[model samples]
Target chain A: MEKAQEIIFAGFGGQGILSMGQTLAYSAMIENKEVSWMPSYGPEMRGGTANCIVIVSKSKISSPIVSKFDSAIVLNQPSLDKFEHAVKPGGLIIYEESSIITPPKRTDIECIGIPAMKEAQKLDKKQVANMIILGAFLKKRPIVKIENILSALKKVLPERHHHLIPLNEQALEVGRKFVQ
Target chain B: MGDNESKNEPRLMKGNEALAEAAIRAGIHAYFGYPITPQSEILEYFTLEMPKRGGVVLQAESELAAINMVYGAAGAGARVMTSSSSPGISLMQEGISYIAAAELPCLIVNINRGGPGLGTIQPSQSDYWQAVKGGGHGDYHLIVLAPSSVQEMADFVFEAFRLAEKYQNPAFILADGALGQMMEKVVLPEEGSLPYTVHNWATSGMGKRKQRNIITSLHMEPEKMEEVNLHLQKKYKEIQKEVRFESILTEDADILLVAYGLGARICQKVVELGREKDIKIGLLRPITLYPFPKTEIAKLASRVQHTIVVEMNAGQMVEDVALAINGKCPVSSVGRMGGMISSPEEVLHYVETMILKHFVSA
Candidate 1:
């Protein structure tokens, strides 16, 4: 496995992109790894597009800002178009085929079009599309254990949101199965 | 010192532990501070630890009350101190002026945060003018120490108290959020250094003093007020000679970066990156914003072609740098307002494009 990886999540405002980045970063920190999660949204957080960068590494990261990303996950068409060329060559690009109509234009990168939203709808939770994407990310780059990710989600999410945890886990399982 | 030198001295500790340790070492007995900030730790440390070592830590209701408490404590000739952040310090200005007017000895610490309003819980160095120009109403000056590192933060608390006693005036430690949050290795002071005596003028409960000593600033006569102001002005002039500090990498450089508090640390990285790129850049980190380090900066002005002042605010400290250099060096300012920190890369880019490129062309 790589010693350091930079992952970016880009999507529409309501797509839980920031939460997904935070969960991944928190999971890495739980495993005693250095991680930095910075979200990008000002007025964009209200209704416009939103994105976040999560860097998980063994050594301390020099700069939190990234000029190029190791992995890019797009949940919307605009996000896909915006970040396609920015993904590093031979890196992975996971796009939700149900929401993002156009695929990435980068030929050198591995593009995996997972129908994450469709899979979440099957689980009767449209909001868990982010979880599905997260599960795919974990399968692609298993830097942290599945148990750690679940525990991290439980710790971060409020008690009222706990009931939805198992369903989100199911969505992740569906994503992992599809990707495998 | 020998016992403390051996086996890591048994000292009670807290977030405010550094201040108490420094206070005891500086021989301070009377502590008058209201709880605020990152500074609540200091108050808690004193409350629990001060009594064990035969000291007084009074938690006042408000910052105004706290500063007034210090004034009273100092009046009684006890080594006195108080602390608060920007908003709380604003409330203490009236009492601070009284202490200044009376020429009493006391130390104050301001752990700064983002402001102009009730800002978020993040670090900022936006209180440059408020601190240097005497935040309280008066024709008075304060001995302001701007500490950039954690070790300096702990050490300056003691230094501020010492300077206060030495000059018979108020001293301030202007610290920001980063220093408060950052954990660094700190050596505890020895135990026997706790109790130090104050001057004969301090009212120790009126025991064997000529009549009862009156600590008042209510001399309504114009001549007396003028005389008081003149005496303060003379003392301030003397303090200018005692204004001591440190500057890193400012000699024979093309671009000079002027920053204080947390911003200075980031500027250090910026200077290092510029040096790697073969750009002659240095930093003038103001350890004391007041006394403004004008002479040191004026000397650097002859050598450095340009200077850039980076701060967490819009443009507070840059004005001081521009004034200090007397326009000999073209000074520009870059900052991020509203609880955001200016990134090192952002500052480096500004230095390269604004200062370095311009100087090279000239």
Candidate 2:
């Protein structure tokens, strides 16, 4: 039916927030789905809050910028507080349970807290935390397959980081476990 | 196509990075640029890339130095380029004017940012006047191409070079911070895809040639300067036929939205949203900001009841839109300044409330 999905991924600079969105966008493109990844950038990127909006559509994406979102993947408390009201009613909000102290206020939307960082700690690689959230996102939305994301990783990840693909896949599996 | 199996595969590339790759494929002999936010990626990509391809990539001391370097390379018949943001573009005005006067064919990319002076490093169409109207002194115009997508961002680099050389003038890819910072899937041109073009008037070396070619903008005599202005005007008149625009859903449109670059991208969504409500809205996206599609808008003006110039600045392109319409219909401006993008909902609301209800009904 040519449905379009708009998602916002938010966290601090070093949290792989942008790359999480990028991975989704790259995976969508692999499926020949039109996609855009718009990052919030500037000097604040030195070490401030970071976020990216990823849109995937069956048809051509009209705009790269949007205020309201179909879903949100927030890694920190500030992002939750900021984007909580921005989600469409009945939309999904997946947050890092350990990072967000205050719960999401919305009663209409489905807000799930997955301890992605806690899960990544068990995997012994903190960098794969965002992939865990990504895995959880896929479990709920199933917008793009997990295998495509792994293939996308091969394209986006540097040569040295290719060794971490298996670790990333394992993290995605851990994230999927929390959703059901 | 060289050795890569997935040569036609779409790669997710940022707009600035895509432009760098496209410039490489367009066979630019050299790239001279200074780093600026949102556009430093083009310079960074070129530095890491051009070395392997036997091309010169230099980070000049400033935007001033970089533009002058473009002039030197171009005068030597090298396909050369440079890029900067709004403030840096302003700094290169004098040099750009000189290049324009000398009729040097080169590519200059301005990833426009907010501002009058060192404005915040955010997206803005404030430079529309600077680019469309003469930014530098004198009677010269750059062939300006405004791209609306990451794909167009790559595609227009090749077009800009072609048009610049064809017209013997400098060309600009006037994109903004949002377009530059965003990433989208694109199928880039193959490496070294462009055919080599020869410049007969180049000062490379005489080497037993009949005449030695000299390149300069300075004319000591007033008659000579007047003659130069006359020829430039004639060339510009010829350049007007190169106007490029896209008309979407204009068949029965009551309201027509005129925009370019990111503004057009945002308004494109507004058209879809407005059409959902049966608002009969359409969009005219001008790909070439100069050589503007004035006649196209004028033709559409007769059909549409009203036209709005959607942009980032307060009302930069609104005048140009008005000029195109020429009192055939009413024209207005809807915009957001300081790098703030006007969301689809905001613009659609403006169309519904401000135009459809207030103007169309009244």
Candidate 3:
């Protein structure tokens, strides 16, 4: 595999942005890739917006800093505005259309605007928008297999969240099918 | 792998648990700590495991009391430790200075959180100065280790005890909240393999070994205290000689990115991106921040055109990096305050626009 790619996920505090980034990072590591998942906490995590950086690399990553991102998943309007311009020209941008008001201006990048929250609510689970975004991210990157992601989620999620796994899996499938 | 070794293979553990496990393997006899974010798990692990193994784990009333408990245990000639995040660590500085003055051997782990004053409960590298420079009163240094991963967190706990005993001083593991909370695969060291057997120097119950030993820093005579200060200075010099660190892609690079702990991990990704674009960048990650790999960094100053010190705090470690370079190379700093981590892209932009600009022009 090539060197690990760096990605950023941004959204409001309750949107599970950090969890999505962490799941992707953990899944990549479970697949034997070097990974780092850093979340913005304190006020940034409590207020209107939150973000996290996940770097998945084949080699020993020297620095986690990125001038440009390989991909970004924006879950809210603030996140979309903050990160849309930072994605590399050919890189992918996964946006949640239900939350993000403004569509990205740049037409050069690969943009996938999914109604993640609406889809989750349609499935009677409004909070799984983060899972929807992760599903989209997986479909776009395919760095780690979906099976690996499911297993990783199982390992990290608390017991109370166990039942949500199947629903999340379905949501992921919905996202994967949409992307396909 | 051999059968025994295979049986002792690595297991996934939280950084906090790994730290406690490593301490036990290193023959640490006592643990004194209070609960704090990113670090409370270490105490939890010790509370459960330490007693089973006949070790002491005491959760004192507060960080102040816990650090003082460590001071007492160290005075009694036992391998001891305490852990906390930024605010809790701030409360321990008074006792830390006392430990330094008395020349007691102990280990401290500071899982850094964002701060100026009770800033946030997130992982941050903001405690650079507080750990590296004297956090407490008086002029003394504590050996500080900055571990970036769960494996390193465990290994360094063992190393910190050994170093503290070897130098007859305090050693710190300056890990951040992220490192403390994250889970990763870690191989616990073999039991009894740690390189510390300090009973000869420890104050073990004042048995018939010569006379009753008293550990104190109460010399009224200024000259006597000056002598003690001189002795501590000599030890610091020796530590500098023994501990030096740096990372690669630094040679002949236009901009040298300097960071420690979590910041360094982020800078690593930035360096990889720079390499792909043929930007010719490098990184200098200081593993030991107190006896900071100064000489190693000074050497890099000659080859690297410019240096950028990236940190979570507002240019704390950057000051040390600048002092190490001493005008040999132009050093600049980029940092975030109130518990924010500098993003890779932000650091890279600064590198290209600021540090590498001079090189591009030349």
Q: lDDT tens digits, residues B73-113, model 1?
A: 88988788888877888888999888988878788888887
- Candidates' DockQ values? 0.05, 0.68, 0.33
True contacts kept of 2: 0.82
The lDDT of each candidate is 0.76, 0.91, 0.81
Better of 1 and 3 by DockQ: 3
TM-score of each: 0.67, 0.97, 0.85
Q: Quick one: ranking by DockQ, best first?
A: 2, 3, 1
The regions of model 2 sitting more than 4 angstroms off are B1-5
lDDT by residue (tens digit), candidate 2, B1-362: 11243666788889998899899889999999899987989999988888887799999999999999999999999999999999999999999999999999999899999898888888888899999887999988999999999999999998998899899999999999989999998999876667767788999999778989999999999999999999999999999999999999988899999999999989999998888887899999999999999999999999989999999998998998899899999898999998888999999989887887667853
- CAPRI-style quality class for the chain A–B interface of candidate 3: acceptable
Best-to-worst order by lDDT is 2, 3, 1
DockQ, candidate no. 2: 0.68
